[model samples]
Target: MNTVTRPRILVVGAGFAGVECVRRLERKLSPDEADVTLVTPFAYQLYLPLLPQVASGVLTPQSIAVSLRRSKKYRTRIIPGGAIGVDLKSKVCVIRTITDEIINEPYDYIVLAPGSITRTFDIPGLTEHAFGMKTLAEAAYIRDHVISQLDLADASQDPAERAARLQFVVVGGGYAGTETAACLQKLTHAAVKRYPRIDPSLIKWHLIDIAPKLMPELGDKLGHSAQEILRRRGIDVSLGVSIEKAGPEEVTFTDGRVIPTRTLIWTAGVVASPLIATLGAETVRGRLAVTAEMTLPGQDGVFALGDSAAVPDKAKDDDSAICPPTAQHAMRQGKVVADNVIATLRGQALKPYVHKDLGLVVDLGGTDAVSKPLGIELRGLPAQFAARGYHWAALRTNVAKVRVATNWTLNAIAGDDFVRTGFQARKPAKLKDFEYTDAYLTPEQVRKQVEGTRALDQ
Candidate 1:
């Protein structure tokens, strides 16, 4: 009987943590030593920070999403699927392929970095009424949805319908919400110029959050500046506000204010993916409890990181302090986890994960931005430069970097081509209830329809 000698390492998800870990492992381990496999639904690592730009026509979607296959130096098999279940005791992972086929793959070592899903509350009508901005597909949908609303407003004869179509409401004032609101607002302003019949003033942008300040983690002065910038642009920056209900064409806030808008973008927050719950390990608020070394206690050869893991921040003295869920921590944790994995294989000591919080940057479209890098607060164009430069440098691929840069350059030189594809609007469901289903039946559906027609004729 022949035996496979090399220990197989399976890394789940192709986000920041999984991709960086795989990249490092490939560089550290020789092909003869161990076999590595990366499983993810998509064959790319999305640079999520710039997704708002994609929605605003400033950058193409592909530019921000880097191809995993491009890096061939890694002797890793790219498996396209999302892991649905993990039997820690049996060292097996059950994954559902893109084609909806379920396969169980046994592994010697496993790294969990499946990232997160949008955290939804039990708010009335939210699931069917509000659109989210957690993935590339969502971002693309938002771009088309916003543009189509404008197009409809221009053609509609009813004043109320036109006003409703033009009004845009963005829930949550976090980094994602702020950026989406800012960038989309700019897109509308630029596009409305082409529609001579429509007044730009008819377009209304409302940014509301339950919190008192926008991006509260960024500290006071900077957060204040951010709110001021949005207000100056005529955005209704409402604080301490919550959505009471959202319907197909209207949204009412807890403050007794009601808005009839076609667009309701939900960027409230993120929670761990449901996959994490199946691990049967200790978790902190839905995130897998991981030690400073990014390993689950008593779970041999199993490690986790990213938004799904509750990793303790060793930099803080308090035992209760856990690391903040940010791309920065996830990216750094990936490198550390890779190093620790190699150390374990070689009988070396593992290093602990510890990182200080770097300041954040909020790009509020065009030259408008708010940033605090190295404790220095900056606003306006300076902040914009920092915001763009930081994200530009963080991209994994050179091709992606250049593509994003070119897109920004082009957008600056010219204005947004705010043309609605009208493809997305034709879907039977509302934008919020949009789900990427394999059952959509594209070419296959057409073929079956034609075959049925021939049978009827015969």
Candidate 2:
């Protein structure tokens, strides 16, 4: 009897792509065929689509943070660290553990899905003053910050200080910024009730984007409709405008308007993980350029997907079109890559990734939403149902699904007490406070770590 050789497969990330791939691989690959390992900073896959809801007190962090340990199907080894670099020639990945210890991991097949970091610009004070919506902690912190502002404003006798605390600014009119602004605005609207001394009119939210349109991908009709919806709700919807200077107490806009504000949430955009740059591969707009198969053009046993790689969009005739970094695409790309990995191990033909746009959903708290599901545009209560329904259905685990459903039901019935958990209350909630973009190893550092250790043994 011949024994099947087990190949080492290393998956980097616990995001939509990495988790899906790992789950699929564990289910399909026989115990004797492949040994799978996952590397991540956290032990759970964060459901990013509904993250804004977490900020608005609609869902708990545990509901969206699907644990990797509770898997009844997967038996893969989980590494509580982040992949800082990958040395392709040596088939080695350098990782920095949560405890701040560094280690080297070798693999036969490597999948780069380290996900993305918040995109920032050269704007001054942006990092020091601006809050982010990229992580679970940031979302929770922002919620507490919003509530704290209301409490401070209600207690303050100085009108200027109260106004500054009550005024909020959100940069980026895309789905994240828009939803964040809308949801948090709703939170403040509800929270102001608890503070009887505070005036609801003092609470102002301004949503601005340098681009001419708000979520242009939603097309002209839906875009205008979404903007109008926000305007009617007392939100200042400004287009082709952005903040020039962000300060702890005030911000100056490019339109020559100086706004007194303390809360500035920046969800402008995201770039690929810096880990991709460590491969010394050519990138498309900071993301690795890959074939339709989600594999490197010339690198064997190497694959990149999700936000880390720019996978070609075969659905579009334009050669330059690459898949957008949406969870919908990332999830499907994961399934394709898993099959291809198994195929390569079995010496079978690898399959290329291909999928159609499944449409988009934008929940705006309460009974407001704008969703284009299956090319059908929906709004108001119908859209809200569709949006939340889609998110509830997309949750990977039954435990997560149940928790989210229960949270939604309870919040709708009894309503939130609007209590701030103060999880990281002492820590300043700023862009620099949450993001660790510069912590990754450079290609030279990666090669040295993998090679220098080899020379020491020799």
Candidate 3:
């Protein structure tokens, strides 16, 4: 008797792209045709756009983290691990499991969607003293840390120490940075009312960016509108400046200004995952270069998309332009990649990925927001409605949408109680603690490790 083997498809990361791809593949392919496997460190798909709300205690972490096992159509074998390296020659990927075990996973078709990491410069003391907003834990930790600062400032008798503890500096004026500052500033502003000893004026927030304008993608009019809203709310908006040096209790800027603050939130930007470099493939601006069909040039059955791939923007009619890294693009690209993969398996024609630009939205916390959807600029409650409405619709699961909406409604009526969850007291939440960039193996190391594992199995 002869038996047929099913083709195995391996996807790395469980971000928006990886999760969407797996969901589509499960719907399209029968069990007999193909087997799907997802490699990730967590069992949930994190809703990243609302991370600022999580940090500000507006939403619970579980509300934004949609579980992978919730769907009845989920047939993919979930491997609780993160891919560290891929050996293109051997068609194997090295993964570091949550328990720190190393294993090599071989595949017939591979999808790289590992996503980007927090981009950091070589400024002194940055890695040691700064906090990142990339992960769920980071957001939760930031909430606790912000509250604890208030608790400490109220108890301190020394004026200098109290001021240092009260002053907060947020670097980066992008969407993440801007929202983080806006949300957390509201958090501090509300929490200070409880501390009768600590005057609200002592709690200062400084938002600085190297760019000349804020949310420049929103155009000059709306961007300035966001700046004015923040300014009126008492946030010091500084443009065309950035951090030159960082210390434990103070930071110096390139403009030769030093501010004392124990909290320094870094949301500067992101770079493509280092895992892409392990494949020894061509890359553009640190992202894996791919054709319009989202396939590598010479590597068969290998594909890349999302933040890790520099996919060409066919809509612009410019060969030099690639799609910008955003949740909107990543989610759509995943569906297209899944279709193309099915086409490859069925011996059909592949489709090129092209999308029209959806305008940007920035939620500045509370009733202040700025948005430009389909080229019509809006602000105040109308913009806030559009911003929240877009995110509420974009949430993947219905349960997530309901939970997020309830949280928003409750927060508006009840307001935050400013309670510290004591997450930071158990473990220090710094940049180095969250991201494990050094956990992956090199290409040479992957080859040797896989060969050794095979020898042991034999």
| Model 1 residue pairs with clashes | none
1-458 per-residue lDDT for model 2 (tens digits): 99666789999998999999998998899887889999998989999989999999989988999988896676899889989889999999999998988888899999999899999999989999999999999999999898889888988999999999999999999999999999888888888888888888989999999999999988888888899989988999899998898988999899999999989999999999989889999899999999899989888899999998999999889989999999999999999999999988889998888888989999998888999999999999999999999999999988999999999999999876688898787787799977787788889999999888778879
Worst 10 residues of 2 by lDDT: 66-75
* Candidates 1 and 3 compared by TM-score, better number: 3
Evaluated at residue 1, the lDDT of candidate 1 is 100
Tens digit of per-residue lDDT, candidate 3, span 344-418:
999999999999888888999999999998899999899999999999999999999999999999999999978
Between candidates 1 and 3, the lDDT winner: 3
Residue-level error in angstroms, candidate 2, position 366 = 0.8
- The lDDT, on a scale of 0 to 1, for candidate 1 is 0.85
Candidate achieving the largest TM-score: 3
RMSD of 1: 7.4
Off by over 4 Å in 3: 424-426
Error of 1 at 424 (Å): 3.7
Q: For this target, which candidate reaches the highest lDDT against the unseen true structure?
A: 3
Error of 3 at 95 (Å): 0.4
- lDDT per residue, candidate 1, 1-458, as tens digits? 99869988999988899989999999999998889999998888999999899888889989988988886575689778788777777677777788987666778889999888787788898878788887787788789988888878999999999999999999989999999999998889888887887888988999999999899988989999988888888899999998999988899998999999878888888888777877667899999998899988998899899999999998889998998788888999999999988887888998999998787888888899999988889998999999999999999989998999999999899868886655466663333454332222333333344455447769
